[model samples]
Target chain A: MDITSPAFKSNVKRALADKQLQRAMGNVKVGFVKKRSAARDKLPEFDQLRDQARDIKDHTLEYLDLYYEIYEQKVREAGGKVHWAATAEDARDIILKICQAHDAKTVTKGKSMIAEEIALNEHLEAAGITPVETDLGEYIIQLRNEPPSHIIGPAIHLNRDQVEASFRRAHDHLPDERSLDEVSELVDEARQVLRQKYIDADVGITGANYLVAETGTSIIVTNEGNGDLTQSLPKVHIVCTSLEKLVPTLEDVSTILRVLARSATGQEFSTYTTLSTGARREGDPDGPEEYHVVILDNGRSDMLGTEFQDMLRCIRCGACMNHCPVYHSVGGHAYGWVYPGPMGSVLTPTLIGVDKAGHLPNASTFCGRCEAVCPMHIPLPKMMRHWREREFEHHLTPRTVRTSLGIWAFLARRPALYHLASSVFIRALKLLAFGRSRLKSVPLAGGWTRHRDLPMPEGRTFQEMWRAGGHE
Target chain B: MSSIDKSKIDTTASRTRILNKLGATLATGKDRDARAEAVKTHLRQHKRNLVPERGNVEGAERIALFRAQAEAVAASVVEVKSADEVPEAITAHLREHNLPARVKHGDDPGLTGLPWGKTPTLERDSGPANGDDAVSLSRAFSAVAETGTLILVSGADNPTTLNFLPENHIVVLDAKDLGGAYEDAWDRVREAYGAGTMPRTVNMISGPSRTADVEQTIQLGAHGPRSLHIIIVNGE
Candidate 1:
């Protein structure tokens, strides 16, 4: 919720030095990458389904307004209410009002990024209503009073010991010497602690993976059934989501569903893919008494026809972040916002201003792993480049960097000068290498050389070698 | 204005503004009727898109694939010859797992009509599951063999609570009701509950609830069923 994107450099420094964070980040590198690749290999139509998923979202966005109208009508017909919010503040207020109207003292929550985007927990706390996060990762971060580092795994930046500490601190009533060194033990402890919260809560809130207009259904694909219990046990259920989550039909969502879990956690299907429509029907033995969906615009409507429009096709799979090299090194908190990794780099700048989040887009190494793995096929690197261009156009880039880029551009426009300068630069770098293949440090490139040694260029440039008949 | 009315007006205005923004981008001087028709047709036609070939097996192969896939996800699957043997199979499973013989189920006639009395020692009750329920049983509306998912619809017959509240969930899925893909399951739902209508909840559960949140090391039975046992009845 804090605008730490402007201080991304400082965040990076701390994250790189954090021993716990680095250790925790190893899980992202080793776990998600292998699982996703293996899952992709098993399904023969994985790529074809991805293409279909992209087309479905593209078609939905193209006719978003009509879909919204139809979706709203269906929700009303099912006796569920739909509320619209044009801004984050509006969304927070709408949810708070719903909670207050129910006279809610406590509200249980399933992991909803829109709730984080709107900063709903803080708003509810200010209103004297306790919001309990039911998702295991979300609940862990809530104890630490931290914003989610990763979208799917909010507490992926935490290790087992850190979770044990959070639990010990929060569940003070539990035995002081209980065995919690095991992951299963820690999971069992949270299950016992949150079970009461699910029942005591007056209302439940969740995020929608896809909102079906055909049946007015909000679907959630979760490995853990926290989302199910969160909505089912409570008297009232609220769905906090954005406009892009809408799909035209159940069949369309099924096509997207085929790719969502595989791209996210590499499962053919998540353990629980629950499709809920309206409130509990008449004679239904157990379910929420009321159903409400809060659709937050939050500047997303502004991205409709823009280059960033492709981003709306995202299913929040977290594959881009999972495969990102920059994310692997620095971890998620370094980005300093709700979302992290490749999707966050492009999205954070749009939600928050580029002036504040300019460093995010620049954080990418342009390795193109994100685009290659993205289930929605979002051109993440291209979008990040667009943000950089916008930052330059608006003069948001630092003056020194701008000046250096200006000089590079000037030289790039003139082929003869570019060749001569590169040749001289290459020879100077070769002399500095002292006949070695690398340089420990370089003048005016301290930042690049600080982390690792820079490889020395050859004595000649490509132009010189080509002219000297080295092409063969 | 009153606070309630003011909030109401704000939401109304926000809805109009959001739709207007979308219109400005998508329908600016374009054929509005064409756009609306395109959306309507897409929703109405509800065409299946790109069903994976992995789930296209038939008959015994489909049932076998479902069992294998479910087992792969840590769910225990047992096949019996008839619905009459479900009680004995469930009792054996409970005894083997060292769980209590008591189980709770919904009022699904298919389940109630079964010879639950065969295992009179197995204490059984009907209605939604309370937090104390250790094992809850519900009949699956259908199953997807492609990914080993069981589809359960919510109603008085099968309350949604039984799916999540219990520590161990035992579901009775008829082999005749199992399908090859998620699309097939959706087709069954459409036939049962007409087009553009759905039960309050349609749960497609592939395995017991699990969480990988703690350092990405997945632990089973996080906030939902720790163990899911499904009994597939092969004979009518």
Candidate 2:
């Protein structure tokens, strides 16, 4: 909702110094990485399924208009409505009107990134309709008035004590002596509080993990069944999703489903993978009476046929973020958007202008782990490099950095001069180190030296070593 | 213009504009017919992709795999010899877990005609769950042995709410309805509901509701059933 990517340097500084955030981020590295590897190891066809998942998305994107038409027709035939929004503002307006028409005072929500992209909750709140986030992590973040730090794990930046504090502050009606010491105790508290919200809310909003054109079904996968309750109990169920979520058939969805949970949370399947087609049918004792799907384009339409087209294949599994080393160090809030990590590095600049989010592309170590672990096989590092090139071409890069790059390029053209200059610089750096192997501080590399010591040159550059006939 | 009228206009304009952008980028010139045909063929055929061998078992092995996978996800499983024994199995499960003797169920014939009368001590009500129920029961349309997932299609017979509202969910899945993989279950769904048609909901429940959102440590019973008990009736 807020563009803090421009201030990413300061955000990273704050995040690095936040001891609680650093400790909480440890879970992302230790928890998601091992679980995903184990789950992938168990399934022999994991890679094949990933390739098939990629193919399915590619095919659908190639004929997306036709698939959208078919999907719309199917949804209408099933007595549901599909409303298309060209932008985030349009999406928020469409959803708010739906709630207003229902005279909704309170609406329960499942975790939907599209809703976050559209800033739907804030819009609804401004319209005097309270939105209750039913997912435990979302509920905790909502109470704290904070955006999700991580997509899959929203309150991941928070520890148990922080959650206990939030619960105490929000649930003032409850007994003060109640125990919120254990994680399970916190879960039970949220479950108890949100159960009534599910029943009382007039409308429900959820995001679709996959939208099937064959049956016009919106599929949501959640370990917590909050989404099932959010949609099933309300009088109106609204699916707020993006155009990229569409697939051609249930079988295609099944192929993708095989890889989604494994990459996201490492479950064979989420506890619930509910496929809802439309509103409550005849003689249906439960489920919403009305169903509506609001599909938002939201700058995604522009990514098509571009180098970033592979990004539309993303299933939002958060695997790239899970495997990301930079993400592990800085955490998600520093990225300052709905998405974070490598996918965000490429995607943020596309949605919000590159002028606002230029630093995001530079926020990577380019270790290639995100692409290796990506189920869609998206070349995230390559995309980020593309963004950097765009940033340079647009003249959005800072003058000092651009001047330095210009100088480097000029020297790079003449290798002999580059070798002489580099050797001189290495000799100067060696003199500065005062015979120590590492320099704690260096004249123009304060950013590197501030965090850790920079190693002194090992007496020779690669070109010098290669030319001495010492290269056996 | 009224806001509703403006919204209607906005919807039409947005749909057209978005579709135009997609068509412009995707269907530029020559191969439009091929792209359309590719989509039509893909949707029409609905071909199955690679199904993992883990769920490719048959007959008794299928049942065994389903039970093992279900237990692996923290769902308890009980196998009975006939539909007549299902009521007793459920009661025994409830008793073992120190739950209430009462259970709410939808009007699915497979569950409705069960000799629930055999277990007179257990109280059973028929309808969708209303949030106060401690246990709810529904019949699985089919189950996938590959992931131990129960596929339940929603209707008058099996309300979708029964699967999620209660603290404990007891599902009665016939052994014959169990398949080896998700693809097999989808095939059954297509045969029953017809191609391109679906019930209001198709819930593929694998285990009791859980959340690992808190420090990524999973805890069960997050706004859904804490315990899921599957009673598999293997009729003679």
Candidate 3:
């Protein structure tokens, strides 16, 4: 909700030293990475499905205007309403107005990144309506008054003891002697507490995984089934989603769904993949009385036809984040935005200005794991590099980086000087090492050497060795 | 106009502005009519992209694959001869789990038509679950044998709450309704409730609800049914 990307350095520093966060983050590698690999292994068509999924998103983005028109027509035909918001403020206003019309005292929410982007909860609170988060991870973060560290696992930065403490503090009305040691017991307590909130809440809001143009349906994939109850028990259902979630048809959604679960959680499918098309039918025994979808543009429309268009295919599966090495070390809060990891690194700059989020793109090691595992085949590293180029063009890069680049560019423009300078530098470094295998610290490269020693260069420069035909 | 009324106009203006911005960004110079037609054709034809090999078998192999996959997700399954055996099978499952014999259900004719009287000890109540109910029953609209998924459409016959509110969900699925892939399940829904329309909710449930949010250790029954027991009635 807050633009702290400018403070990413301090956030990462705090995160690295946080013993509780480091322990909690250990589960991401052990739990998600292995499960995803095994799930991919079982499916022979996973890669093919990724390619087709990418094509589907590409086709949709190319014809986005036509598709949005059709999707709106379908929603209207199905006895539902579609609301559009050009900005985050517009989105927050629309949702608050809807809540006011319903005379809502409390609004229940499923996990929605759009809601976070718009800061809907704070807006509701300001309007005198209590916003309740039903997703377990979202609920824990709501209690702690913290933003989600991870997209899927909002409280991934918090360990069990911290969760136990949060629950005990929040649910003080309950017995103090209750055993909260088991994870199952904690889940049961939250379920019991939130069950009443679902029944009493006046409005329910959920995020869409995919919006089907053919049926005007909103799909949500979840294992907890909180989104289902959030929409089902309430009188009004509002789907807060972005424009890029739309797919052409149910069949297209099926192609993407095949890869979504495997890449996210390594399951064939989530426990509940519910598709809600419209308001309750005439004879329907139980469902919402009204349905509305708020489609937020929020700067995504500008990415079309640009190099960043590939980023629109992202399914928000968190596969890229799970495989990201920087994310593993720093955790998600270090990215200083709602989205975290590699996807956040590229997307944060687009939503927020690149000037504020310049540090995010520079944080990546460019390991390319995010690109390799992305179900939509988004070129995460390439997009980050694009952001870096934008940062450099704007003179947003730090002074030391600019000076080093300027010197390197001056020498690179002259081939003879480049070769001579590199040869001299190599000889000086070799002589300084004095036959040692490594250097513990080096001048002007303390950042690299601070973590580990730099290996010593063999005597000659690479250019000299190549000219002498050392290997050929 | 009032603020609420003005917001209505704002939405239409916002929609136009967003779409126009997208058009400007794209600037592909393609015919709008052709693109709309292509999207319509893609949906009308229901062009399937790829169906995994595991769920693409025929006849007996398909059901077996469905059973294995369902079991892999920790859903218990029982094969019965006919609808007559469904009530008894459900009773046995509830007894094995030491749950109450009373079950809540919706107004599904398929489920209501069963010989529930045969299970004298089982008490059947008709309505949606109220969160206090431990066991609930409904009939699945169709199932996908590929991933062992059950597709249930929401209506008076099968309320959506019965699928989530109860702790133990027992669904009576017909063997005839099980298909080879998700595409086939969609076909069945289209056949029953026409094209370009769907029930308020279509739940494609693969197993009971679960969550790994607490320390990444999955604990079942996070906010929905803890145990999913399916009675596959053959000779439908």
Give the lDDT of residue A407 in candidate 1.
97
Q: DockQ each candidate and list the results.
A: 0.67, 0.68, 0.64
Model 2 has an lDDT value of 0.91
TM-score of each: 0.97, 0.97, 0.97
Each prediction's RMSD to truth: 2.0, 1.9, 1.9
Residue-level lDDT tens digits of model 3 in B1-236: 13335335358889889988887776467776777788778778878888888787877787888899888888999999888889889889988999999999998889888887799899888887777889999898999987889999999778899999899999888988999888898888888889878888999999999998888889998988899999898773
TM-score for predicted model 2 compared with the true structure: 0.97
- Pairs clashing within candidate 2: none
What are the per-residue Cα lDDT tens digits for candidate 3 across A1-472? Answer: 6778899999999989999888988998789999999999999998999999999999888778877888899888777888999999989988988888888999999999999999999999999999999999999999999999888888888888899999999999999999999999999999999989988999999999999988899999999999999999988899999999999888899999999999998998888999999888888888888888999989998888788989989899999999998999999988888889999999999999999999999999999999999999899999999999999999999998999999999999999999999988988898888789999988888888999998988778887888799665
Candidate 2, residues A17-45: lDDT per residue as tens digits? 99999999998899999999999999999
Candidate 3 Cα errors over 4 Å, as ranges: A468-472, B1-10
Best by lDDT: 1
Q: Estimate candidate 3's alpha-carbon lDDT, on a 0 to 1 scale.
A: 0.90
